[model samples]
Target chain A: MSVVYGRVALIGLGLIASSMAWGMRRAGLAEEIVGTARSAQTRETAREIGLCDRVVDTAAEAVKDADLVVLAVPVGVMGAVAEEIGPHLKQGATVSDVGSVKRAVIAAVGPHIPDGVNFIPAHPLAGTEHSGPRSGFAELFDNRFCLLVPAENSDRQAVDRLRAYWEGLGANVEEMDADHHDLVLAVTSHAPHLIAYTMVGVADDLRRVTDSEVIKYSAAGFRDFTRIAASDPTMWRDVFLTNKDATLEILGRFTEELFALQRAIRTGDGDMLFDYFTRTRAIRRSIIDAGQDTDAPDFGRSKVHP
Target chain B: MSVVYGRVALIGLGLIASSMAWGMRRAGLAEEIVGTARSAQTRETAREIGLCDRVVDTAAEAVKDADLVVLAVPVGVMGAVAEEIGPHLKQGATVSDVGSVKRAVIAAVGPHIPDGVNFIPAHPLAGTEHSGPRSGFAELFDNRFCLLVPAENSDRQAVDRLRAYWEGLGANVEEMDADHHDLVLAVTSHAPHLIAYTMVGVADDLRRVTDSEVIKYSAAGFRDFTRIAASDPTMWRDVFLTNKDATLEILGRFTEELFALQRAIRTGDGDMLFDYFTRTRAIRRSIIDAGQDTDAPDFGRSKVHP
Candidate 1:
């Protein structure tokens, strides 16, 4: 028989945590879920929204008897949340987080975790551009991958328990080091988001072109960047701050590549431009073949699940 | 009653022309739609797809008795197409185009135009990543803007006539100078596409990161860039070649902005990153208000589209 964690504590009621909470209740994976936030209004909101079984006013109250505690706040705030809840966590409990940049998060939150608790860091590679408690959906983890970065000295049983919880919510789990996670996400997500945010910002600053015109003409290419740029500001800000090294490393490579392309454009090197575009188109094909997304809106509604 | 053009000839059967053919037919705005392509295969495909009323082998044959001619090929091919059609165009005929880069296209095709022929350069700021006749849709122009770039010396009647033709196809027409059109699009469309293409290419070239992983985790942000990179290689190649100056200028601005953000990330400047993200988010909001796209999905049948 699958056992539900007796008292699960979620320190932040943001998109990832709220979704996890909803998923836990929906799957009956947790016997009782408790949540705490820095603001009283978020706690009340969590209670009203049924985000948790108990919405405690203080972090200490939230984690008092919890067997599992998840920190789903921005990476920059993970240390503070960890410090606030450190003394209150139940003995031998498993603690984890869903921060994008893992190394900084683990570095900041690791020292505060009690010696007995397993501090496993994980990231569920799924989300919409929207954020906050209300923006989360139970099916967000459907068909998605959860990356786990367990400490070398972490208890094996604790890792399995957390894996089971995520699997119950419909995720495929894999393990990697915190450094690898930061680098992978830096290339695939962080740098891409930064480029998008920058381009959208440039378009916004141009007085010669109206914002209406920019949006109206966005179908050509700009709308995609806008969607990416629309992602949570606070979350992204924290990501940039925490994953500074890897992100800057990727950004350096990105700018170098961009400069080469710019040089090709200035010199009217059609062959170079054509070759670059030709190579990238295959990547899109690979992404589709991997079943990451169904490219066919050519057919009817595929699924309305999430 | 808005009058249909006596005869409309489209030189080149690519995405833009195919879409225009569908849009014109659906709106019942063109008396006859004639198309011409360099390749026998493309002409056959155009005929098989029923994109135009008549698919001719020669541009001259297509433009012979036409009142309006639309050159919808690569920007690099515009001059040759214009030269072929110039002698065959009827007196008082309006000749226009759907090139992404305006000034270069105008300069290239301008010298070949007959004295009596009205060369009104226009670009429909619309397309999909897919190309060719099979991808055409009537509603492509329904809510899209068509920008017309007419020189100061151009005939007023011809410009008005071409405007009527596009408006009849359900496009809202806006008049702009060719130079200004190139500059605006260089910033909004061309440069953004180059950046996306470069980033995707960078990801493709990296050996440390697996392609499958990048594809799997793309919902983070990379999926959006593929949409632009998937565009026709030849067309985009030509766009970069023809709009070199303006694209490079905007690209310089983009690099400077990107470097500034990179430095902030390196310095762990959370305040700077937060403010930057917050500022960029507003532009997306304004774009949504402009009806370019929904806050989530800009395309139809997408989750964000209501």
Candidate 2:
């Protein structure tokens, strides 16, 4: 593969940015890659690991003369980083972001872009519970959906180039409006994460069941919730803060369904519970059929006999 | 790995019973294994899969002259099955069960046992979303917990022999009271399952996000919930109906915690959300350390990059 960009600058040295750098290097998507992080420890770790071709002290220095500038910081800091790097962005460079929420990122970073530069917002809907620069690998985005949300007046060539770059990283890229992206993500990711956190927290607070017992017997179902709830606190906090309306809307629907199920349990309505569970079972089949997850038992968890 | 029982009878040939049959055969824990299922299809499947040495038509026939009897049916029918087999149970036989709720199984199956028989209740804290005879494997119980709830004055030799059999099958065994087991399971399994079902149901009912989109974008977190919610409907319905008090109690606590998190989200309280999430993260680490789950990224999911 040939280089799509002369130099690419990653503004945050975290899981997504580190993975992008590794994947791009593996596929030769960029001629040179530079990265910067606010934390001195993170920058030092990235330098030691050879995460990029160069590690710079500041975002402004990293973006200077770069053909592609990726704002990979937390959602809350995307605007601030954009403002800091606005004056240093190269003329005609393509500026994009990898924030989970699209509308807020566009609103925060759109105005700071210079007239000649093109701004395209993209979100790769893929991750594990692990975070940090050390937790990334070249295959993180492989077979995952990377939704690109281009502003209405955005340059067509810029959007297509970004799509090609993501494709080179092994992601299937699709175009979506900002509002639809947030709504769809809220249904799929944001609300489910919050609900998992709540369930884990509730289990933690139960005094009757010791923490050790919960941990020991976690294979039943609670372990899955813990894995989701264990995601990076800062990233998820920003997601909830930025995608407030959609998360709350889906959560409201979740509470209503929960109440109905609770009523069925209280009333001993076996039929209602059975029908609801059966319907949900069909959705799992669809997800597996669509290649989102495996059909193996217990996600093919390891069997370690102690 | 010597045979511990002359003949063992499994009343229902589902995931648990079939797995027990396979595991017992692998370790030579029982000389002869006999099984029966209510549905003709299940019986045929059991016979085809060789799940048991003998696939009998009636629970009474399965239990007749057997040294050990295991009632592995749904919680709601444990009593009926117990009554059917009680008269046929051999004197000095040990009767056990594999229900999720211990107190209810004890109450339902305890009275019918003949005076000379030893009645004990057990719950295996392990299973997959898949069910039926075909889904069983010898390694299903590896490194899992099997909690035994024995009535006062239970025969010590019978309890010890059962523990040895489970150990031979690669499960760690523990003893607990019936009521305590119910509450602990409610915290670990029942409430988590109900919450997953409710969340999936909410996503399914949403008109804004089509089912295909939900299925496609499920890898984030919703996919795990769907896996849990895909569990057998009849078994889960019976669990909720039988263990109403404990499940309701845990769900009430879950709702209270969820409301607090929801309020924090509405008010943009990032600190509160971050703190709660960070606290839950520690529990996941403990689960990994306890060997209940693997720490591999994305649960070691298969990478199918298209």
Candidate 3:
């Protein structure tokens, strides 16, 4: 395959950036991949693991002479990193970010982009609960959706090339407006994650059920919540802060639905509960039919890994 | 292994009962296993699958000569089934159930037991979302917890024998009082399941996000909730209905914690969110260490299953 980018700069050393680097290398999408992390330890680890062709000490150095610069840092610091790398970005380069919250990222980093550069934002809707540089694998994005949110004034050619880059890395790319992306994500990801964290926190605070008991008996349903709750805290905190309104809106809906269900339980309205559950059960079938998840029993969660 | 019971009867041949039948056969723990279900179709399916040595037409016939009778029905129907089989139960026989809510089962089935029969109730903390006769598997109980809630003044010998029977089925057995068992499960399983159902219901209700969008993008976090929400609606309705107080108590705590986290998100308290997430993340590690779940990436969920 021909290289899609002569030089690709990844400005974070976490799971998403490392997986992007590996995915690009797997398909020969980038001629050279340079990455930089804010922490010296992360930079050292990236270099030691050969996560990129060159690991730089600063984001500025990483973006220099690069045709594509991916600002994959935390959403909270994306603007500062963009400010630091803005002047060093090559003219006519394409700058993209892998932030979960698109509106905030656009607001934070959009102003610093040079006139000649095309700024596009994308989010790959795929990940395991595990994070960090070592946790990445090349197959992370295979058959997954990578949403591209192009600014209204963005160049069509640049957007096409960015979509091509993601496709080359084995992601199915679709274009969505930033506002819709945030709301969709709020429904699909943000609210669910916060709910999981809240459930786990509640379990942790229960005095009657010890921590060991909760952990030991978790395989039924609580374990899945724990898996979601275990995601990188810094990343999630930034997500809730940046995508506040959409997440809150979805959560509001969730609380109302929950209260209704609770009321049914209190009132012993078994029919209502049954109908709701039956309806939601069909959605699971739809998801499996869409090839988004496995249909294997127990979600095919193996008891042991060899 | 030697036969633990000369004759065993399984009423309500659903997932748990059929699995128990297969598990007993796997360990050679029962000399003869007889089963019956209210649904004639279920009985026919059990016969076609060789689910028992004899598929009886009535619960009375199934329990006529059985030394151990397992009432593996929904919590709501246990009392009626117990009454139907009560007169036919052999003298000095041991009777147990595989209901999710122990207190409710005890309340329902306790009165119908004959003077000489030992009425011990047990709840196996394991299952797949799939249900019915064909969903049964011998390995379903392997390494999972089967909690025994012994009745007051219950025979110690009968309790020990039932525990041995479960152990022979490849489960780790522990005994708890009925109230404590209900409270513990409400914390571990019941509340989490209700929350999952509510989240999935909320997503399904959102007109802004089409069902296709929810199913396609569910891989991020909502898919897990859907898997849990796909469980048998009849069983869950019974569970939430019978274990009302404990479930409501845990959900009360959950709501309080959720509101605190929601307030933090609204107030842009990144530190609070981060700290809460970090604390819950440690619990995932604890779950992994406890061997309740695998540490395999993505819960070792297969991408494709043939």
Candidate 4:
């Protein structure tokens, strides 16, 4: 748990980057943390909040001589950021990313990595609706699963070091092939988001017909969809764009099943509705049993910190 | 706030009935809260937990001399229960119900109400995924909205009295025609439930293909669907069957929008995806601003006390 990386450079100062910085400091995993943001205002704000040991003018300068360089940019910008840091990354330095889509990030950042640096593409399946440097906390990675999608012939020593780094920050790590990772995440995150966005859009358009009725009675269940749909537009846009194939695959299955349910509703098949509802209830129970989610519907109604 | 109804009776005690009983007692809105269930075991459990003042054997007995008879039964059973309690309901009594579908409940129960009795259908826009008497809490109605779908030519006094009773329980009250209420709720509750149920069914079937990856990597947002799908099967079965028209209407609209998004994803139309995502995000923010939902993306982080 001692400082493993003397200099840990975070390329983006968003929620993931700031949270990792907090975790690094809290766990004493990094002696110095350097960060860079595209906008001067965010860099200034990140510095004001003490999100890192040093704030840099460019990705290359931030990552220069750093023992571990983390790419936390949008998926669309991963290639450019990787190219910027490729020449300056220290020898044998471990390079990693925290993007939602794994395949696209690997494709974009893979070529830019210096041969000596370990390019480990990891996605920590943890986040809040909030974003930006000021929004992170130390325990954000606690008990969360982080999937590392490394090349088949990735250096074991580099992989082990990166594993140790995430473990030190309190994340449980597993490794998978990049395509399988995308497919798994397509079912878990990407399709759910698109469906949520679709439903929210429908509800919004229906508001034109129903006026404020959607907002008024939303406490029933539509409210939750709204929250999921309210995710960062730019981030989700990139996720859909980068994770297109897998997302489309799952969405196809989803729409097919939705059509079946729609037919059941149209045909007055109550039993079909009941059976589907009953089966889904067990899945929620399984998630709770797996220790991934809480059994209580609303986080046990826990109080929020002021 | 004086007692608005003396000798109040509730038939078919489940989430809504039990919650109504608890809230009525807490607010002193009912002089005596009597209840009836189909089985003696439930009656005993209801009495043991103080869910009702007097647990009765028959719906008819429970309704005798009651100034307000709240039919909190399954949509499918509304007719039978109304017929049984029709003769015993006291003259000048106000009869209201807390069923999801207003038009169906009215059609089932309308003929049974005597000339002097007023049948004011209501859909209380409140509940948790949990069911049964033990799940009930007095504060479940606090800050929630209640829709009173009063029958045409309904008694004004009875409507006002019921409104006062609900207000005493800390709910905002609105009046809508039974048909309109069913349509509005079909969008907010029924359609959402069907979609959740269908998605959960899809995931459950994918268990073999995805193995435990579905639960382990559920952080991607599939967990929310599980929670929504875990709601009571009987209640939702009844919702779909009773509100078929509105649910189907909304389902058609949802499918169309989902298809548009799916096509965008299939064609790599980032502009369309971004626009849909951005539009949905605004609706979510509006719902939060309207106070219908918390800003929390994961309600599991919430500490909502029952």
Candidate 5:
């Protein structure tokens, strides 16, 4: 309810940063929110939408004298953004990033941090397929988990302050080591996203099943893959590139499992397919029970559309 | 609306059948609906919920004097249900089905239709992961598609009446041949379901990533796969077994495309990955434009949850 930071700097005006700005204002978590993006159009759009208290022209200008600076850029560009704003950061300012991958982010942004500045890597496990400034809302982070990956020698006060700030923005924050966080996300997010992209691509490339037919009959199941596959391309490309090792491991496992299921289907092994399907259903139940997803049928879309 | 059928018998009491019952009642499309199921508990649930005008204990009893008999059972069990009810069907009654795989259902149920009894196969492209009589909703077919696969010599009047009945139930109707219907569904529904099941199983089998972690962080994109994987096991198992060839073909294509994407990720070929992802996004746009899915971010869960 109170200000967690006197001044907050958001270095990318994409979905995450725009959402953070809206959520921060909703909870009065920051006295002043300054935002900037690499693209002039994005910066102009943010200003036009009143997304931040101050829409600066550059990351350097945005981070100047800010008590907390968050880099919400794609993983590939975190280093450049950090180098640009490093000198402008105020003394005792905490530097953090909302990148999907933490180990790569820490590696890229760690060197630019000054002696008194704290650099903590955090990933908010929340997003929609839609991207950009206009696609964000305050409820994006509500009831979602935000993992904070802080170094061993990081300042405790700074880490706690960042945790409080995210909590104020309606996220449940938990501390995770960089390596474990990457592996966990590889299984839960990266691998699944790549698989969805692959399936959607295959559907599109099939000559026999016309594109119109694919789109028209999508509600049977493929539409869900399209939704996941529609996520920001550059962001996801960086995710796969930076988190390559862990993601490849998960994909290897996924391919092996998929081949086995395909074999079962080919061999008419009904029991294997049935057992696998039954086991996976339990995990869905656990997700609903954990409050990570809605139990309403069809993700409660019937309610939304009706 | 006037009654489309004087008496309609539903041979299976699952999500599709129950939903049809509710939709029929909502539109007054059927004067009297008779339903039956293999499991006593399902029949009990249907009776308790008043899912039909009458709940019979056997498929034979349910089809007696019925003007339209719909075999709403699993793909694998369609033949047996058809055989059981064939003798009891009225002389001029029309026999239809709501199976996922049209060719297989046609093969399985075709031989049993006595002369003068019209046999037309239909598949409705609508459902949720939830199953059972209680999961049925009148609006389940609203704005969804229903494909009709009538035999070459089939009675034209019977097919027209069935199309009108589905239209009254709030679905758009289309005529598709059984073979093309099978292939289209293999790409859109069956293969997608198998891939989702495989991904969920891989996540569950990975001991390194605890189940709690997957459940907690599923909002990152994996939850959609879980929803698809949570569909009724028996129905999906039958779908895979009956539509084996087409599904295997699609899976082959999916695996090949996935390998290409994986190679790009391994080689750090960002352009290839980005291009593939961008193309997939266009298909998602088409699906949205076609009204096959909701465009709301996160499928509009934020609104439902907030």
Candidate 6:
């Protein structure tokens, strides 16, 4: 395909940005790609790996003369980076972000957009436990859902162009309201991550189990929680903090349901446990049917088994 | 790789027993693997799949003259199957089980064992989300832990033979006491499974999020919980019913720790959240380093990327 934008700027050189660089290059989504990071070490790594067409020293420098600019930094720093790059954003350029929490990101970065710049917030529901510049590949976003949150009264052509660009990068783009996106993400990602983190922490704090035993026997179930818990701490921290109310709401529901199941176990309610488990199995079937996850047993990790 | 047992009787033809059939055949651990299931359909499937050397119609017929008899049924039914097979067990035979909960299985099955017969309960800490006769594989036990819980006065020779057989099946065998084994399994498998089930149930119960949204966006984190929660309903129900005290205890601790983290989130304690998450990250590294799980990104599901 042809270039979706004359030039694209990435304000962070982490997993998402590096992946975007490779994916965009693979599909020829942009004529030129400029990237920057707050950490000099990250910038050096990106440059050494040739993550983008040009590695700049600042977000402002990266945004200059760019037709499309994506803020791929942590949620906590979105506003600061937006403020720094707002004036440098070229007129008529479309500015988008890849933050997980949409409402908070829109609230944080929307004000800093210049008059002629269109700000769109997009989040791709895809990732691995690994992070940073070297941990990304071009297929990271392939067939993954990328939710686009465009402001009311925004430029229609720009939104369409950004959606096309995401399609070019191999993601299925769908428009969603920022608030609904946060709520959906809270249920699907944020609360589950917190629960995994909590379970892993509980295992770690148990003195009788011993860390070695936990590590050795983790294949039974606990290792999946550990993988989710091992995701980048800072990014997750910002996710929970920014998506606070929705996450807490879902978690509250989780605790209530957990208590009910605990009561069933205590009361020896075999039928209740069986019915609940049976219902949850259907959802897994639907996930596989939707092409969102693999139906291969154990998430296809059997290949890794010794 | 010589025959460890002249004839091994598997009392059930489910995932564990079927996998044991393949694993034993792969290593020639048993001269003959005779199997039976309470369900005729399961027995037919076993016959169709060649899951055993001989597929008998009853536990009694399967255990006749067998050197090693393994009760590979659900934990809640151990007593009945043990009672049925006890009188038929050979005088010098070894009768063991692959139940997840040791204390309960030992308590239920011990009194039924006849004189001169050895009763050793074992639990293989390995499985997948799939079940039934067709889901079995030769490598299901490969490098996974198999905990052996021998009675205080059990025969040393029988126990050693059983351990060797499991090793030949590609598992690392460890000897543990019954009560301790239950508690350890509660922490590693039972509690995590309950949490996953609870979390998945909550997501399904959420009316506002919609089922399709949860299934589509699930790759973020919820898919892992769903995969775990999709485990065989009957087996998990029996597991919770049999291992009640320890599972409830670990879950109690899990809820306590989760509440603390929730409080931190509510109070905007970023340091506490970050520190807890960072600490959990080390556990994943240890699990991977110990070779219990793969460190490849997304558990190496990247290969399935579209």
Each candidate's root-mean-square deviation in Å? 2.6, 2.9, 2.0, 1.9, 2.1, 2.4
Tens-digit per-residue lDDT, A70-107, candidate 3: 98888999999999999999998999988889999999
User: What lDDT score is found at residue A184 in candidate 1?
Assistant: 89
lDDT per residue as tens, model 2, A78-153? 9999999999999999999899999899899998998999999999988778788887778878888999999889
Interface RMSD of 6: 3.2
How close to the true structure is residue B65 of candidate 2, measured as C-alpha lDDT? Answer: 94
TM-score (all chains, Cα) for each model: 0.94, 0.97, 0.97, 0.96, 0.97, 0.97
Q: What does DockQ give for each predicted structure?
A: 0.54, 0.61, 0.66, 0.67, 0.66, 0.63
Off by over 4 Å in 6: A297-306, B297-306
i-RMSD values for every candidate model:
2.8, 3.8, 2.5, 2.2, 2.9, 3.2
Mind sharing the TM-score for model 2?
0.97
Clash totals for all models, in order? 1, 0, 0, 5, 0, 0
Off by over 4 Å in 5: A297-306, B297-306
**TM-score (2 decimals) of chain A in model 5:** 0.97
User: Candidate 6, clashing residue pairs?
Assistant: none
Question: Candidate 1 docking category?
Answer: medium
Tens digit per residue, CA lDDT, model 1, B170-201: 77899988777887888779988998998898
Count: clashes, candidate 6: 0
Candidate 2, B223-259: lDDT as tens digits: 8999999999999999999999999999999999989
Candidate 6 on B24-124: residue-level lDDT in tens?
98899998999999999999999997889899899999999999999989888989998888888899999999999998888899999999999989999
DockQ of 1: 0.54
Better of 4 and 5 by DockQ: 4
Top-DockQ candidate index? 4
TM-score of 3: 0.97
- Considering only chain B, report the TM-score of each candidate against the true chain B: 0.96, 0.97, 0.97, 0.96, 0.97, 0.97
For model 2 chain B, where is the 10-residue window of minimal lDDT? B297-306
- State in Å the error of residue A276, model 5: 0.8
DockQ of 3: 0.66
